[model samples]
Target: MVVGGSLGGLAAAHELRAAGADVAVHERSAPRTPAHGAGIVVRPDIEALLHRLGVPVEAVAVELYESRRLDVDGRAVREEAPQWMTAWDVLHRVLREPLADVCHRLDGALRRVRVEGHEVTAEFSDGYTAHGNFLVGADGIGSATRRLLDPSFRPAYAGYVGWRGLEPESRLPGDLRELLSGRLTHFTSDGMQMLCSLVPGPGGELEKGARRVNWVWYVNVAERDLPALLPGRSARRSASFLPPGDVPPETAERVVREAEASLPPALAELVRLSDPFAQPVLDVPPWRMVADHAALIGDAAGTVRPHTSVAASKAFGDAAGLATALLGWTPAQPLPAVALEHWEVLRLDRLVTLAGTGRELAAASGLGVGAGRTFFTGD
Candidate 1:
């Protein structure tokens, strides 16, 4: 069983089913329309999962032909390979296509989990109990599974926050469209890093005029300002992020003002006209990932800072790794714990490296590994 119905949990459910395992996803959150959760840089791990599920993903993403860092003269420092950009909403849909035969129950929040003999049992908030040979914690950064497994682990928050915005491609001034729409652009100043690229519009509208420009500005925020800054739009402090529309008009304006003062003209204008939100940059340590017969996947395993841009891909990697191990193990040699162990061994190394790199980039305030090279050598 997978807890949390977002990208991680759903991908875990999909991968396990593909490996011929009977899977069920239990979500605590109420079922609702998937909002454009956040913009993501599409990587091969995500593409491979989509291909395996036969989910058509071409229409769900905006193709970016280049990536470059800007110099003081406003010229590109260097250009790199093309990449695809899309929203979490689109990828979530892609992962969910194959779950029709799998049990995906919403509002089934897990209240307690324990291992009895060789079986793992999960008690849900709705008072439902389920037993399985193995359980996976694909929850999220605020993962209940992680806490239950190792209460000693806590996510570390950086001294900075990522301010985000999404604007219609057509809404951008015509002169800036060509520079920003088909490419991922970056600017660094005063130790702050800002990036902008295009992504498919809501519902995956790929037309030229229908696409959206996505930007993330990493800025330093003092501890004293956090309470006011975070609650500007959302009334409560997020363990991770405050989604759009919760940001107050005045606070969004201040963010725009900062962007104008700090970012390049094109990105600054994008922030000025777009609806905005913010999420704290968090650092988390490497998890054991596996405890007894249960495994932690996605953000549950480790919260890689956003600088890696693999938050979703990392979850897919974990799910895919676990699924592969389960698929290759023969019944005669079947040891659920051994398979989980192997997967955990491989995932821990990866997650630790990612967390370190994320910290480095966040430490640099967003300029490190901005080109997707340091984070990924191959899928």
Candidate 2:
């Protein structure tokens, strides 16, 4: 049984079914793509999963040739190696389409997980219950299963938020039209940093004029100011993210002004014209990933900063590793803790390294400078 029906849970179910095991996924929220999302830098691990699942590389993916660091005037300081990047929406659709025929329980929240002897039973908010040999938690960073297992686990703030934007190629000013196409560009100065790259347009359009240029800017947000930066109906949801128009106009304008004052001309223009969105950069620790017959995977396992470009890859790795461990283990068989323990040991190391690298880079004085590549290079 799998809890959460996002990419992580879907991938887990996919891998398990491929390994000849019956799987069922339960999701708390509606099974639909979120309106607010960001871009992801795809790595080989995710590519391998796609190939393994026979999911073709559709036009939804955009190739990046070089990452160019620019000066205040948009002049190149240096160029670094490139990689492929895609939108969260595109990958979600690709992963979900194949599972259309899979056993999915949408809009069902897991209220309780009861372990009796060797069997684990999951009770949902919809009055439905499921019995399985093992449970996989793919419910994201705020996973209920993770909370039930380890109450002390909480995401540590990185002292800043990753301010992101998705602007269309067509809407761009004529002067900056060729600035970010076919390349990942960035600007860094004083303590401010920003990066830009092309991602597939809406519905994964690959055409030059139809694509979207994605950018992210990191800025300090003191703990006291977080409540103001994040505006919800109630202050309790400050930890949650806020989309463009929902953010306070004053705060949004201040962010745009900061971008204009700190970033290069091209990036500043992109930010000025973008629909702003903000997500706090967080660090997650190595929690008890496996408790008896239950396992925590995906963001539920670790929420690393996005600098490493391993967010989705880690999810794929978790799914692949868990599937391999349960290769022929059936739901009717006795659940073994040895394989789950081994899987957690292997997963924690990678998660710790990725989180460490992201925090270090984020704290570096010259984060976007030096053409330095320290994380997830397959190195």
Candidate 3:
């Protein structure tokens, strides 16, 4: 059974079914249409996973060139690396086709796990229970499975928040338009950093009123300030919960005004035009990726900072690896701790290195000088 029916869970279920196993996915959210972020950068590992899952890589738009531009006070530096930017919804749509046969139980929030000698059962908040040979937690960062298994593990705030939004390419001012029209661009100075990129839309190319430019700007703030910045209402209910719209009107106005005062002109203009949204940055220390018959994948397993642009790839890797291990499972040896341990051993080193690299690069970007390409290049 796969707990959490997002990309990781869906991928895991698809892989298991291909290997001739019956799979079921339990998700907490309502059965609404799939929605995701503006775009995602696909790496080699993610590409390989998609290929292995019988997904035609060519069906999805792939950005093949390596274009990296970093600017500080208008002076720029450039480098090359293998990268592809594709809309998140496009990737999800491609993956969803193969998972049609899999049983997806929506509105089934995992409340607790019951692990007996050789079998595991999951109890959901909606009074449903599922029995399976094993349980895989792809439940994201605030995973109930993780809490039940290891309550000691908690996500630590990363000392900053990422404010992100998307705007049409045509709406940008002339100077801002020229700076961010093509190529992935970044501007960094004095504890502030901004990234803007032209990413393909659902329609593929920008013909007239079609394409969008995505933006993510990072700024450091005290942890105490987050409550005031977050939307005053509960985050669990709203599907697209964001700080500006959810907070009191007066507070929201003040936050926008403050952002305009502190951010650069191009970034400030984007914010002025954008319906602002905020995501609190957080990182998890490495954990034993497996415990008993259950294993954590994706954000639930652990998350590194986004500076490395490896979170999605790492989650894809986890799903692929776990599927491979489960293929050899037999009735006599229902769950093999050793096999899971091997997977954990392989991932731990990479996670540690990535966390350190992200922290260092974030610190450097905060200091005004642009960071070196080591983090992005994986060197």
Specify the highest-TM-score model's number.
Answer: 2
Please give the distance, in angstroms, between residue 86's alpha carbon in candidate 1 and its true position after superposition: 2.0
Write the residue-wise lDDT of candidate 1 on 1-379 in tens digits: 7787898788788787778888888887778734544788778888887787675567678888878787645767667658888897777776777677777888766778888666788998888998887788887777888888887878776667778877788887887788886788998765578888888887789998888888887776654567777784436777677778888887787787777766777667778888888877766677688777778888888888887898889998999998887785443554666667787888898888888887776666433323211210111
Which residues of candidate 3, in runs, are more than 4 Å off? 33-38, 53-59, 62-76, 80-82, 170-178, 202-209, 232-252, 367-379
lDDT of 2 by residue, 229-253 (tens): 6774333354646665566667668
Q: Order of all candidates by TM-score, from best down to worst? A: 2, 1, 3
Worst 10 residues of 2 by lDDT: 370-379
Over 1-379, each residue of candidate 3 has an lDDT whose tens digit, in order, gives 8998877777777777766678899989888634544457777766886788765555465443445455433555666644567666667667777778778889878988888877888899999989987888988777778888887877777766677776666777767766665467777666667776766666555443455677777777565556555655454322123543444555446546755666555566777776656666777777777887888888787777777777777888788788787776864675766777788888777777787887887887772123322111111
Q: Alpha carbon lDDT of residue 306, candidate 1? A: 81
> What's each prediction's clash count?
3, 0, 1
User: lDDT of candidate 2?
Assistant: 0.76
Candidate 1's TM-score = 0.89
TM-score of each: 0.89, 0.90, 0.85
Which model, 2 or 3, shows the larger TM-score? 2
